[model samples]
Target: MHNEPLAYRMRPKNIDEIAGQEEIIGKNTALYHLIKKGHVPSMLLYGEPGIGKTSLAHAIAGTSDLPFISLNATVSGKKEVEDVVAEARVTGKVLLFLDEIHRFNKLQQDTLLPHVEKGSIVLIGATTENPFHDVNPAIRSRCGEIKQLKRLEASDLLGVLHRALTDQERGLGKQSIRITEAQLLKIAEGVNGDARKALNVLESVVIASDEENGETIVEDWLVDNLIGRIGLFSDKKGSHFYNLLSALQKSIRGSDVNAAIYYLAHLLETGDLVAVNRRLLVIAYEDIGLAAPHIGAHVLAATEAAVRLGMPEARIPLANAVIEMCLASKSNSAYKAFDAAVRAINSGNTGDIPPHLRDTHYAGAAELGHVGYQYPHNTPIGSFGGWIDQQYLPDKVEGTEFYRPVQAGDEVKLAAIYERMKEMKKNKR
Candidate 1:
């Protein structure tokens, strides 16, 4: 308002003034509990940008009456954290706020963990990525995670736009700017639920307005200016993680190996190495799965190597891993089969394990009518020693082969193996 940046000027000072995130800001929520009674926790706040992570950190700071010391994980290291912790000893209710904390290396992250664990500082950290995969285990283990969902509804962004236009000391009220319902709605929808983005776009309008008789109406030209001003190859990293991830996932899902590879390269080149680990591992399982079953092992191992080796040295391995991963010959029989089977189980048709398939490890098994469970390995077929009438998959589920392997590349061999196993198990009875 007073020549400050729109983001800072528009920041809410009180709980009621804070927008959205009612679930977290509510009295019974974790952050609210930490606030109301001053029960601050060593916690990680993760979500996309403009979802109130930073503002929530401030709300926590304000509620606790602590000397909130914040450091950028992109720049700060162990030395800085240690210095802050030492200063916090004399201070009462010390809270250390870490932003973009996923940027810290393992050793750097490792250092702050002990202090958080030992209660030296009530650590409140923020990240745009999933901390479970993004943060080192040492730091993540000691902290509680409060997931902040991205703004997805038009109403949510509208609320912020309204606040920004009306909030006297903070928003366009300082400049006496006004906007029509349709124009505001258009801007809100364009923001895609990002409150910061919505406000920023509004700020552009406020600055561009010519003060038409002292009331500002955001015109179409200004709207075009805002959208057109956003550069394609700009800072699309932190603020647009989900967007990039969606594009990456869609590229893979749509079977465009080149586009998928391009996304992976972008992700590895800029984002964390471990970010792709989980999805790649799943692709190995879901897409590759039983087809080239060993590919999962390769994908997982490459992720580990990338993390251990870090950048430059890690680049080739990451690229190679994802390349093999993308071209591993897709198949979703594992997913299709598992999903169908899960639907059956969840619908309460999960019949008990047949006596023949159960209880060989216990002591009283042979004594309590626990007999006639044949050992398939000792049979003539050397396996699959069960009879078809045995109902090994439960009477209602027998002979239900959910995983029908695809007739492509490696899956053909996998399908044959599954067939053989079914045959062997069928004869064992």
Candidate 2:
């Protein structure tokens, strides 16, 4: 039994035998229907580890009754890819599933495009990283994408454990091993949503049933793996990653300073610090603009300081920066107003920049008669833009208000000055 590979013996024989990933394996799916119609496209499946991507690909190949040639992109170079392509061309309908498909460099990935175009081989790829980030654009452009999700439900894990225990050939039926539900659930709870890890844990649990002499029993001192403790924290690059980050971003955006700091701490302790900094920078500009212009600057300075400080020393600066961003008065006025003005101009509002305000800092100034621009400060009436007949937002649309400012922090001061200037010009006109 030790000489035989566990995965080979345990691999699901058919789609019915496989568990999870019903999102892709369930009825009416593109892959399911295409296999039925005898017209399956080259596909790519992406998700966290132990989510059954390779199993699905193998099952698909079985349905076609064609030889499945599995390739690992990480090790295979361009020459190897070319050889596979040659074989595929000769076979005409073989299934080639490339695991870690994104690991293939651009040149290696390109080797498959021409062969794929000719339909010599059906290319199915499996990747762990987000396909949009990891896969070559050309490969993604040609293949339909199937995204697998991490194991979440404890019941789903229990299903795998039971199948392993009572599946006759696959389970412990070969030996006289008796186990209670408590021990099994403990192993299952420690599995961290990965079926392969769960099965491996079961094997270990059985082997150590009696720690001292290796005798069989339901009780033993079982050492927990890293994946086991991971289930306790709940975010070891799994489902909680996105949700946690989302809450962090919104915390800063909504100006909850304390909450933002708390989220930053959680990310630093459980997630990536660099990612937290990246989001903080975005939150600074996107959510807090001219109203609190210092927010973006503060975040950038904090990032630079963190890079210089490094590791343990960097934590305080990171927290301070995130707090600063949250404490900053919120404003999207500058961005919204700028976008509005641009939209109006692009929509065919070919207007002039009032002659009085046109660029006068040039060589041949007097020849152009660039004067009569009341410098507002010099005149009581202040002919701000010369004759008010000058167009600003085209003749069809005059008085298009764009830059409305929020009354907070620096924006309040700017808005007041801006309004006063606007009032004087409109009063004279």
Candidate 3:
């Protein structure tokens, strides 16, 4: 219809008509062949908004020659699903395209399980949220494949714009419009890989433009006026935020100061100073550990200052901490040692504490097996205060070693001390 939105009007009629997602429906791809052969299966598609999860479902239905039934999980209930099932029974087979499928509760999801399993309803569920995290495992497992659609690139959006501009049947081809390739690209890039958004913005600009001598001129300024200040794609509770955090830690761990700063700035843009500070603290201890032990205290101080300063100003201290962490000598020796010790304990290596190492503070302790406890403070061997050679570990783990200090920063000195102690203990001196 002429009144329909350009994006809806330009919806691809089939897999071949779809502009992007070549990886999923490219002619040579398995899904393409499956759809072409009328073998479409129940599937779950997920990604960011406007990347065409619904479009893919419709295209698959079109290619498979199956009746397409649409419903939104947020609004649709068991009764609606039952109606679809009832229709499927009559039709023999039907493609059910459930939008916002992650919003479905366990009971609601379970309602479709039998129908999906029996092949009566070929479910093509779509969601912006990650299915693995939000969808029930039963629904996820029943899907033929959990397809992860990517954000449409700027080039993909450009193609979508070109199609809309030329297609007289569904697009603006009937009108005489003047818009440059650069201006089209501006619309494409401004939407941040969202073709639907791109088309909407394009429509807004076109409608705003007045006819000048039989030509509707869409200008550069018009596009910018509509798509003001594009923000980075990130959600505090979503996968992308975690990805930014991961990238920040990894860059710092790899000692790439530039990359570390970039990711830090990216996270800072999200205004999550607490998350940034917390992750920085973790990086300091977990990655930079005994290598530069003071780094932990430094990071703690920086994070504290950041909390006190808050926001706009908080970024300064965080940037300082990120830089320091990126350049700091890295060693996971201490982290690894603790993990190894845990592994030993998990594997049942724990045994009773040696008699000499057990606590002796309780009354009548000497009567029990806790006697013969060697107090290290009582025996000092030349410059080694509070030191002695005695069995400390339980018999089962007596000789098991965990702390292996690496040659990094202050840990090098620790390694030497550790070696001397080990040698002294070995000689029982």
Greater TM-score among 2 and 3 belongs to 3
Residue 230 miss distance in model 3 (angstroms): 3.3
Lowest lDDT sum, 10 consecutive residues, model 1, at 229-238
Put down candidate 1 lDDT per residue, 1-429, tens digits, no spaces.
268777677776656566777776766566666567767877788876667788778877777777888889899877997788777777744888889877877766656666687887788789987787777777777787556555546787787778777777677666666668888778777765677777777787777877678666667777867855231222344545555666776676566778888887667655566666666676677776666777878878887887888887787776777667667667778899989899888888766677777776789987766677765444444343433334568777777777777876688977886777777666775
TM-score of each: 0.58, 0.69, 0.91
Over the stretch 230-250, how does candidate 3's per-residue lDDT look in tens digits?
525667767778878999999
> For residues 296-381, could you state the per-residue lDDT of candidate 2 as single tens digits?
88889998788788777778888888777777788888888989988987998666555555678998765676655644344343
Between prediction 1 and prediction 3, which has the larger lDDT? 3
How far off is model 2, as Cα RMSD? 6.0
Q: What is the C-alpha lDDT of each candidate?
A: 0.72, 0.72, 0.86
The stretch of ten residues in a row with the least summed lDDT in candidate 3 is 229-238
Q: How close is candidate 2 to the true structure, as a TM-score?
A: 0.69
How high is the lDDT of residue 91 in model 2? 73
